[model samples]
Target: MEELILTIVKPLVDYPEDVKILVNEDEGRITYQLSVHKEDMGKVIGKQGRVAKSIRTVVYAAAGSTQQKKVFLEIID
Candidate 1:
């Protein structure tokens, strides 16, 4: 899951090396906290959060066939 998020986000940022993902699991819920270079935040999020929403949708669909845990995405600055 970490690698999946990285693969999706790295190319969208100016500082690919600064992109990071932290995963947390609690009570059957999985949360992916993504952090990128401050300047690249806008790129990852895109206009009106469409990019972020799209990313989350992709991740959700990818995880659909796996365990039935809830998934959450957080883009942190």
Candidate 2:
């Protein structure tokens, strides 16, 4: 899951090395905190949050097979 988020975000940022993803799992829920260089925030989030929504949708779909677990994505500056 961490790798997936990294793969998706690295290409969108000017500083790929600055992209960081932290995963926390508890109580059957998985939370992913994604932090990128400040300049790349807009690229990851996109206009009006469309890109962020798309990223979340993909994550949800990928986790659909594991219905017992819930996935959450947080994009941090």
Candidate 3:
């Protein structure tokens, strides 16, 4: 899951090497934490958050057929 997230998100940022992702399972939900260079934050989020929304959508879809749980994405500084 972390690899999938990285594969999809790394290209959008300025510092691909600085991109980091962490996943945690608590109860029945999964939370994904994405950390990247400060300069690349806006690019990852995009205007009006559309880019972020798209990313989450892709992650949700990719997680399909595995578990019937919720997925969450967070950008951590």
Q: Candidate 1 at 31: error in angstroms?
A: 0.5
Flag clash pairs in model 1.
none
Error of 3 at 7 (Å): 0.8
Each model's total of backbone clashes: 0, 0, 0
Ordered by lDDT, highest first, the candidates read 1, 3, 2
* Per-prediction TM-score to the true structure, in the order listed: 0.95, 0.92, 0.91
Cα deviation at 44, candidate 2, in Å, is: 0.6
RMSD of 1: 0.8
Model 2 lDDT tens row, 23-76: 889998989999999989999999999999999998888887765889999998
Candidate 1 residues lying further than 4 Å off, grouped into runs, are: none
Task: Write down the lDDT that model 1 would get.
Answer: 0.91
Stretches of candidate 2 exceeding 4 Å from the true structure: none
Q: List the residue pairs that clash in candidate 2.
A: none
lDDT of each: 0.91, 0.88, 0.89
